[model samples]
Target: MSARLAPVDMTAFSPGRCARLIVKVGSALLVDPDGQVRRDWLKGLVADIAGRVRAGQQVAVVSSGAIALGARRLKLPKGGRASLEDAQAAAATGQIALSGVWAELLHGEGLTAAQILVTLDDLEDRRRYLNVSATLDRLLKLGVLPVINENDSVATEEIRFGDNDRLAARVASAAGADGVILLSDVDGLYDRNPTTHPDAVMIPVVEKLDARIESMADRGSASGMGSGGMVSKIEAARIATSAGAHLAIATGRIDHPLQALATTGHGTIFVASQGARARKAWLRGGLTAKGTIHIDAGAVEALRQGRSLLSAGATRVEGRFARGDLVVIAGPDGTQLARGLAEYDHVDAHRITGRRSEDLGTILGYAPRSALVHRSHMALL
Candidate 1:
C-alpha cells in the first residue's frame, strides 16, 4: 500500500474562459431609478471592454434600458409594466439616447459600435436568423462592436422576448460566441436569498440546469430586477450552454463590473455543454455517420478547443454524405473525435478539401460557407 496523500479541495470557485463573449447589461446598471445614465459606472464597463478587445476577445452587448428611460420621461405608473401603447412610445423616445450613449462610450475606447434592434420573431424565423447571424459575423470581422436590444417600439406581445438575458443567449448562439456574461443586481445563484438567510450559500458553478437547480430562483416579482429574475437566467443558461457557450451571472452593481468577473468570489458559471443539449445529445448517440473526414493534427486541436472544422484543415475525405447529413470528424490516424452536420455534400466536400475558406466559393462556384461543420451543428464525443 502507498502512503496516503493530502486531500485537495474541489469546491472553490475559479473563473475560466471567454474568447468571443456576449455581455448583457441590465437596466439597473445603466439607468438609475431616476432614468439617468450612470456615466461613471458605464465608463468603467467600457474600459473593461477595451481591455477585452486588447486581449483579442470579441464582444457583443445586449442592453435593456429603453423602456425604463421611456417610462420615466412619460411619467408612467408608480409600480408596474406600462401598457403596450405606452411602452411603444417610451421605447421610440428613449432608444435614441440609449444608442447614443453606447456609441459615445465605445468610441472613447477607440472601438466602433453598431446598434441592432430585434424582436423574438426575428430569431425564430430561419431566414431572419441567418440574416442576423451574417450581419453580426460581418460586424465582428470588420472590428466593430455590436449593441443589440429588443425593438420594443413596434413588437407586440407575440414577438416580444420578455428579458434581455434570453435575447443575449439567442444572439450569442447566432454570433457563434463561446461565452455569455449576465451582469445583474445579485452576485450569483444562491440556495436562498442571501439577504434573508445568513447561511445561504452561493453556487459558484452550475454543471446542469436540472429542475432542482432551477427551483432556486427567487420566484418573486420581476424575479429580482426590472424584468429579469433567476427564472429567466436559468432559461438563458439552458440556451447558451446548450450551444456550447460558457455563461456567467455576475453582479453589475460594482464599478468596473466586467473586470470584476475573475477577482470577485461572487458569481455562478454554467459550464459549456460537451454534447449535452438535446440536438447535440442526439448527434452524439443516435446518428449513423455516412462519411468520414480525415483532418490534420491542427484541425484535431481546433476541434478539441471547441471550434468548427475548416475544410482547409482536412487531409482527406472518405465515403459519401450530403449536406446536413451526419459525418464523422476523424484524426489523420483514424481516431474519431466528433460527428456533425455537413455544410457541403460529399462531392463538394471532397473537391474543397485542403482549400482555404476564402477560396471555397472560387472552387465550388458559389458563396462559401466559413466552415465544413458549424460548431452548433457538431457534437464532440
Candidate 2:
C-alpha cells in the first residue's frame, strides 16, 4: 500500500494554530524598572499560556529577567553593563527566585513548570542537541510546560554577552516547534525606530528574509533593556524559520501580550516555507524501521484523529529497537498505519505495552516522558 502525505497544516506557519509553540519573553517585560519581578503581568500571561494548553497546543516558555531580579536582590548596578563574573553571580542568585516565581505562577493555572537551562554550546553539540530534543518532546507530551533559560551561571556568552532571542529560536528548532513568539518591548519589526520616530511604519509580516529585511535592524531598531536588540531577533528569525518554525516579534510590554498578538495580530510574523518533516531526508533514506508497535483498534482510531499512540492502546511490541530509534506502527489487523521515533526501547516497551500512562512511573520506577509515540513525531501512512 502507498502512503499519502497530509499537511502538518500549521508547519507552513501560523503561530495561532501551531501544534507546538515557544513563547519568548524578555527581561524588560518580566522585570520592573526597579529590578522586581512583574507578578501581575505574569499572572495574565500565565492565564494566556493556560488557555493555549487547554486548547491542546503544547506551549513552552523561554523567559528572561533572572539577572535583573538577582541584581536587585544583591544590590548590583542597574546600568546593564555588569562584568561576566558579576553577571554569572547574579544569574546564580536569581535563578532560584526565578524558578520559584515561575512555579508559583504556572501552578495557579494548574500547569506544572519544568525548568530547563542550557547554553548555546549545548545546542551546537550534536549529542547534546538530540538529548535536548528528546527531553523537550517528552515534556510537551506529558502536559508539563517547560520554562527554558540560558545557563548564565556558568556560561561565558549567554546573558553576560548575548540575548534570549537567539536562544529561544534554538530551543524552538530543537523542539521541532511550529511557531515562536518573541515578546519584546516593540510591537514588531519597523521600517525605522518606533520609539524615536513616530512616523515610523511597522512591518506586519515578513514572508522572506532579505538584505532589505536585514537593513531594518541597522536603522536603530534595538529598543529594550535586553541585549539582543533587533539584530539578534532578526538572527533568531533566520534560525527559527530555517528550521521550519515561524517566529514573531511582538510587544510584551502590555498585559496579556500573547492574547493581544493572537486576537489583534499586532506583530511582525516571519513565516516558514516548510515543515520540520519537509526535509524527510531520513524517511526518504528508506532505512527499515527497527521495530513495530501493534496497536489496538482504539489507538488506531486515536491516531487517525491526530492523537498520540499511547501504551494503553498498544497490544504488542516487536523487533529490537532502542529508544529514539525509528519504529513502525501497525494496527490490530497487522497493517502498517504509521512510523515514528520511539519513546522507549524494545525491552522496556515490551514490559509495559498495555500499561496506562499514569501507572508508568510505578512500573518503570521513574517518571515517563511520553506515551508510546507522540503525535508530533509520528507520520501516518
Candidate 3:
C-alpha cells in the first residue's frame, strides 16, 4: 500500500480570522546583498498590510535590518565579523534611515507607521511590560501601524533579544495578537535541511513542538544577512503558540508575502495550544502573589462556580499590595484557592473587608470596581 497522507485545513491559515496580527520581516527580506533596502518588496508588503488594515484587522511589523543598513551607510568592512560597538554605531545610523523608508512607504499606502524600539527588559519587567502593552494598544486603537524593532543601538549581548523572531513573539503576546507570521528566505520548516538533503519534506502543520521536531531544526540562518535560523524560528513558534497565537513561517522572496501565505497556504502553520482566554489564564497562573486574601467558605464555593470574589466574602487581607498586583485568594482555613489582579490597594482592601458592595463607597470614600477580584482576571487553582 502507498503511504497515507494527512488532511490539510486551508481555512486555518486565513489571516482574516485574526483580529490582531504580527508580521516579522527578517533582515534578508528588507535588505539586499549590497546593503540597500529592497523597495519593491517593501512596497508589496505595505500593500498587503494596507489590505489587512482595510479588512479591519490590526497589524504590527517587527523588522530587522538596522545593522546591515547602518554598516553599508558607514562604509564599514563587509564580510568580516564586526565588534559590538561597531554594530551598535551602525544600528544608530541605520535605524533613522530604516524608519524614514517605512514612514514614506506606509504613508503612500495612506497608513501612519509609528516606530517602536524596545529591548528585552521592556518586556521582562512587569511595570515596563504593562506600559509597552498600553502604548501598542493605544497606537492600534488610533489606527496606526506599529513598526517594532529591537533597540540594538543600546542593547548589549547580555540584554539583547538577539533576533527579531523572539521579539516578534513577545510583541504578539503583549499585543494580544491572534497570529504571528515570520517571513523568511525559505518556504517553511522541513523534516531535514532541505538545502543539504534532496529528499527532505516540508511540514504543513505543527500541532505541537515535540523533542523529535526540535531535533530536526537546523542551526544557522539560510540568509547570511539575518541572525535567526530555523532553531530560533522554532523557539519563536513555541513562545507564540504557548501564548495562544498561531505562528506561520513562510517565504518573503515573493511579492505580497502576507497575502500569499494567507490565500495560498504557502507556509508551515503552528496551531495555538489554547485560545485568548486560556492565554490570560496562563498569565494569571504565572504571576507571583504579592499578598493573600482570606475568603469565607461561601466565597470559595462561589469562585469554584465561576463567580467573582466580592468584598462581602473577603474576610481578611494580608500583605501590602497595590492595585493591579497579583494576589492569592485563600479559603478561611488558609488553603490557596485562586490568584488574580487586585482591584483595591491593601489599605482600601483592609477597610472594605467583609463589607457589602453597596457599602464600598461609604467605607473607602470612593468606589472603583464592584468585585474585589473580577472573574475575568482571576484563575482558579
Find the candidate with the highest TM-score and give its number: 3
Model 1 agreement with the true structure over 1-381: per-residue lDDT tens digits:
001112212233222356678999988788787778889999999999888877878888999888777777777764126578877888887788999999999999999999999999998864576568778988987889999999989999888998898999999888878788898877778877676777777777788889889878885533222678888888999998887777888888789887767655457888777733643676787668889999999999999998999999998888888776789999988999999878788899999998998898889998988788878668888
For model 3, residues 108-223, the per-residue Cα lDDT tens digits are 99999999999999988755665677678779988999999999899988888888999999999888789999999877888888888877887889998999889889988877
> Relative to the true structure, how large is the alpha-carbon lDDT of every model?
0.81, 0.80, 0.85
- The count of backbone overlaps in candidate 3 is 0
Candidate 1 has what TM-score? 0.74
Could you give the candidate ranking by TM-score, starting with the highest?
A: 3, 1, 2
Error of 3 at 329 (Å): 7.1
Model 3 quality (TM-score): 0.81
In candidate 3, which residue ranges exceed 4 Å CA deviation?
1-8, 78-81, 284-287, 292-318, 322-324, 328-338, 341-381
Give every collision pair in model 3.
Answer: none
- Counted clashes in each candidate structure: 0, 0, 0
Model 1's number of clashes is 0
- The sequence of per-residue lDDT tens digits that candidate 2 reaches over residues 1-381 is 001111122333455688999999888888887778889999999999999999999999998888877877788774233787777888898888998999999999999999999987788764466579888988999999999998888888532327889999889878989889999876677787656776777777788999999888842324345676888899999888887788888778788987877766767888875666542334434768999999999999999998988889999999998876789999988999988878788988988889998988888888785778777567788
Which residue pairs collide, candidate 1? none
Q: TM-scores across all candidates? A: 0.74, 0.72, 0.81
